[model samples]
Target: MTERQALVVRGGWEGHHPVEATDEFVPHLKEHGYTIRIEDSPAVYADGAYMETVDLIVQCVTMSTIERDELAGLIAAVENGTGLAGWHGGIADSYRSSSDYLHLIGGQFACHPGKAPAERKGEQADNFVPYRVEMLPAAAEHPITQGIGDFDLVTEQYWVLADDYVDVLATTTQAVREWDPWHRPVTSPAIWTRQWGRGRVFVCTPGHDMDVVRDRNVTTIIERGMLWASR
Candidate 1:
């Protein structure tokens, strides 16, 4: 039997609490029989030899900078066959200043246009809001969403600008109201999958906080996604 290994990198903007979020996910990987190694920074990416052994990479780092060499190794690992999976701003909102990283990931966080007025704080968008996720036709048969159904969530409904290659799994259509400035009903991809070289990438834009991930349906789908993406 072959030993399974996974690398979990966590850091970046403090607002998302990367440490807490990664803490919540590590056990899930462990439960699947993976020997997980956790890193608080991307420096681990500098070791090309070490990265080659990883079967999956679960990155929770939000908006943070990565040194050129470090970024190169991480990209190479994934391109060579290491699976990559993450959710929310951690992956989509990561490395805001790096276009190369964004290109590899296939999507960028555009905006959360439907944030509730009461939840909004200063310039930063609100974290909690009631919403419903609609499953996409293409995702109906996908392993990650097989048993999952449309469900409601109390978190930000990320409106992403995805690349043409992404296989959208689910979407959330924000309701429109007269008082809302953005009247047009907005549809955001809630979950998606993409391929990078010989590797697989899976992303879910719903895990804003631990509570959001605690949703039974959300947990099930994300777990299934991790398994589907793993090599």
Candidate 2:
């Protein structure tokens, strides 16, 4: 079989460590017969020449903006049978102003509420807490979730605004932070798949920290997800 072509568009917020995060998965994808292309900017999304032939795009950009034509190019690429797959803020939280981009992704990061630190300094820090990722029984037979049982992970548990159109495979609840009274027991989609024209969209929101992205459970699911989403 010909090697599958994959483009990893990395760069945005340094906090997410896009370079390190994307690097960790490079070898895994290579083992799965993928020839990877790494781009440090979202500008790669605008390259119709490159996007036209890529089998998969694993975006790792967070809280970044895309040019109007670039965003349109990405949309067109996916709609024209180029698969789009990503995790965390890279694919989901990116491009806040682009509804068309969000429409393609099927979800967006609203918040990541964690338990507040016990000790008080002059200022408070982002709560980094633990949560469990639960895979729905219906996804048991799905390619991405097969043999992937529920597991507990410590990271920034994201509360996302998700669309019903995607095939939800896994989820995490919002009961970690007692501070947020309104968000208790609210289940959010952690892993899901959507269709954009002839292409596929795969999303997972577990990799806030590099450690979380390196977790075998997360990496395994992502490996499978990339193959599943590839054209």
Best model per lDDT: 2
Per-residue alpha-carbon lDDT of candidate 2 for residues 175-212, written as tens digits (9 for 90 to 100) = 73555568447899999999999899999998877788
Clashing pairs in 1: none
Return the TM-score for each candidate structure. 0.91, 0.93
Collision count for each candidate, in order: 0, 0
lDDT of 1: 0.84
Candidate 1 per-residue C-alpha lDDT over 1-231 given as tens digits, one digit per residue, 9 for 90 to 100? 456899989988877778887787778888888999999998998899999999999898988898899889888988899999988888999988888888888888987664556656765446456789889777778899986778998777787877788888998887776657675887777899988899899999988777877788888887888878888
Residue 100 in candidate 2 has what lDDT? 85
Cα lDDT of candidate 2 equals: 0.86
- Please report, as a residue range, the 10-residue window in candidate 1 with the lowest summed lDDT: 119-128
Alpha carbon lDDT of residue 126, candidate 2? Answer: 49
TM-score of 1: 0.91
